[model samples]
Target: MSKRPYLIERYPPSDRFNHWFVAITFILVALSGLALFHPAFFFLSHLLGGGPWTRILHPFIGVVMFVAFLALALRFWGHNFLTGNDRQWLRQMDDVVTNQEEKLPAVGRYNAGQKLFFWTMVISILLLLITGILIWQPYFAPYVPIVLIRVAVLVHALSAFVAITGLIIHIYAAIWVKGSVGAMTRGTVTEAWTRQHHLDWYRKIKKGEIRGHDHY
Candidate 1:
């Protein structure tokens, strides 16, 4: 019998669930938010019922997204801090885009790009939550001064733009990098995949410096 290919677990089931939860909530919130943002996108409101319902649900969904992301952020917080190698990886963007992995630094479980994306999501989500509250009508906005609320609206839209742009890149990168989506979906990646993409991480796994759900 052919032996099963050795695999390394990258994420446990809980982390995958946490990731997907935030992703689902983000889609919901983004749709509803866009519907409320402009007349051109008003048609998008149908996804969440209609304009009024979309308006009502948008903030609530955003709150849920923020909470879910917070959980994920806490879980991966340690993994995202940039190191010297990570900075070098960032500086070698040409090698990255050209798929010259050997020319670049050995990447960790999360590369510099991935770590930056993680922090971008964290900052944007936090800003969205804060500004979403400031401009929230009929609840907290009424008590706030008009000037601050007006400022909050602009900041909210700006932050949303940043977040949406980052998410697009994140999705594209996931698709561009073979086995990346699988690492999240199945919570494991082949040993070869790990070695090629994240050699440092692979070395640590071999040395037992890092533990995963399973190793073979």
Candidate 2:
């Protein structure tokens, strides 16, 4: 008989639900926003109904995504703060890309790349929200100056580009790093996977220094 792998708790059910909720809303908002952005992507409007419906719903979906992301950001903000070890880890990008994690600094719950991505998402989303409001039709844009509205449109597009790029990289990394998706999907990870990817976190968990609501 094969030995069963030991499992470690990662995200709890609530966290996973929150993550997926944000993810779904993001997809909807991205598609609708794209439909409004360019004629090339206008076909996507059909997914939500038609161009008129897409225009009406995009901002509302964005608001929901923003609120959901706010809750997620608060939940994981503490884990994402950069540290001296994280700096060292960042300096070892060559090792990280080459599957030489052993040669790099011990990783925490998030690696340096993940932390940077988190902050990037935070900034991008904030800019998107601010600029989005400035250009929002019927509700807010009419009160804003035309010059600022133009600038806000530019900023909104740039922010969306950065965020979409970051999201692509995030998805690629999740797939490239085996077992990462399971943390969000199943809300747990194999002990061996945790030890290999986030050794410092694994040690803390083993030492009872990082107890959560869920037990391993």
Candidate 1 residue lDDT tens string, 39-87: 9999999998998889888999999899999999999999999999999
Model 2, TM vs. native: 0.97
Per-candidate Cα RMSD to the true structure, in Å, reads: 1.0, 1.4
Clashes of 2: 0
> Could you tell me the TM-score of candidate 1?
0.98
The digit string of per-residue lDDT tens for model 2 on 52-118 reads 9998999998998999999999999999999999999988889999999899888999999999999
lDDT for predicted candidate 2 compared with the true structure: 0.92
Rate residue 33 of model 2 by lDDT: 90
Per-model TM-score, in order, reads 0.98, 0.97
Most TM-score-accurate candidate: 1
Look at candidate 1 and tell me the lDDT of residue 105.
91
